[model samples]
Target: MRTTHPHPTNAVEPPIAGTAEARRVSPNAGWWRVIGTVLGIMLLLVAYYWVHKPLDLSLVLRLGGLLLDLAVNIALFVAGGALGRALLASLNWAVVSRGERIAFEALAGLGVISTGALLAGMAGLFRGVFLWLIVAVAFLIAMRRGGGSWLVDARAFTRALRPIDRWARLWGIVACALLAMALARALAPPFAWDALNYHLVGPARYLSEGRIVPAPDNFYLGFPQLLELLFGVAMSAFGRDTVAAPLHFGFGVLGLILVAGLVRRHTDVRAGWLAVALPLSATSFWLLFGWPYVDLAVFAYGAAVLVAAVNWREHRETGWLVVAGVALGFGAGTKYTAGLLAIGLAAMIVVEARSRALRPLLLAGGVA
Candidate 1:
């Protein structure tokens, strides 16, 4: 009765101190978010201006050709990837994620396409029209052989993607910046030291001769030229040496993709992004993307071998072993240094064999 004199015992209390102020902070937080977004946009604009000052008519004209060259270059890769898919359709890919499988297909396709180009160049069939016809044939074969399934699978994978966490976001940003810079550098005229000395020189000579000829004076020509022949294909298709730079960039980008996929297969998605950023963070590797060099090709083919070998180890399927062997062969064909990878991979196969079996060793050694 005494408590009820002023108010009921169970009555609601008054609002707590500072409650209104805390409620007001939500709108302020939203305003800050808006400000941050606007500032980020402005920063990006400033960076663009800093990089490309006084963009002139001549620059604009060159941009059109650049776009065309890039388109043709990408088209060739896509066609090659389709052919690769067709070639690998029989393999059991249950061990890998779809993204990883696509990467494998792309790497394989590049090997196949380059090998075809090398053969064509050897036969004096490296003309622009013939290259275009080869691209057409690859596309036709792919469409006839269940090509739509890959597109569907890719779409499913895209739909399944969710926003990455903070760490992955950071790494993704760095990877994108490095890739963009590499592309810009590739667009510039060829002035890299090694590129001028032999990389571009060999392909230029091969294209001019209309066949693969022995270049005794340039000792580098005697080395494996798997990637150089692809450069020749690009140059012949586009009628410019500049096209090869972008092609090199493409190889580097694919190498990063293979790396990311392999890491994701072994660990988690975030680690995959980290793997991509880590390799690209190196100045030399990033710069190699802009030069008409085979380093990136070796990196890509080597990654392919690793991924295929891992798949084989998990599934114990000879097809995956064959895939790994093919990748190793292509890598060795790109550069002599890649033979080191073959040695390492051969040892790995021997160590992994059942009771140290001789069959696996023989198959791997012969393939390598």
Candidate 2:
């Protein structure tokens, strides 16, 4: 009774409040950044040599053009990325926090833009090594920043690639078959009369212009600029006659790769293989793959949308939903048929979100 109660001397200090310390870059990250910076400089030099030597533009104009090209490319990438992100937000399928999603979208946009520019340059829109350098730098930066793993899970990728793994083996077979078909087409002349009439023709026109413009005379034919624009880049590099067929073949391969990846994500190896094979066997697929029509691009984007939808459904990630919407938008832009898929997907999203009382579903739908 004489001693006062001991003062609470050991009360735990409240843990530091607010946000945690910013994540430190890993040693691996620093190493990658160093490598990227070096590679970027080298590529820039290569670009200088290629653009200035043969093109013979006045020094002032060349500098101006380079700046202009970079500006335009960056703008396009940003716009596409924003549109894609907005679409994902609407669908209630985003995986990361908003801040992380923004970063990821920016990276993805850069990747797509670089891809477009590289393709355009390769097609001969500009005889500059600088464009390639820009693309290389952008791509390297994306990979180093962990953007390369954005769309699909890399951890699962190796397992997906395993030969003994049923899914991997199936995908492998599908890949081989697709390759053989492409080889066959390449060895022969390009098919699908429509390709020659519209797809290749539009790109050839764009390459000649060194810019893009709507071909009003071909009004009945819709032109989605992304792939054609890339084709134009190639034509600039290789000359139209030499590049057109091969470029189409290349795009076809890319489409197949996208499809295979989507299928792999959605189902097991066997199902993925079947999804790929079904498209391969379809007459339309053969026509699209063998010819230079934009259908393959449409298919690729459409499949991407479907895959994004599935991702949204499974994970409740708004980013995925937004991506699906963007993919759908691009698919619709590429071809009218994709609209049906987009409509169906939108309906499903609404129903699912309504059932779950998720706010993101409403947000995603509005964006889409």
lDDT of candidates 1 onward, in order: 0.79, 0.54
What local lDDT score does residue 351 receive in model 1, on the 0 to 100 scale?
78
* Residues 1-368, model 2: lDDT tens digits: 57765666666544443323212423365577789999999999889977767545576664554344434333333343453343233444233323234333533353365356646544554433444444455555555555444333322433444455666577667656775776456434445577667767776665565545557789644544555554454445435333444445544544454555555555555665565566677666665555655666666666566666767788877667766666666566566777788567867777777766456555555544
Error of 2 at 284 (Å): 3.0
Q: Estimate TM-scores for all models.
A: 0.80, 0.56
Report the number of clashing residue pairs per model: 0, 30
Number of the predicted model whose lDDT against the real structure is largest: 1
lDDT for 76 (candidate 1): 68
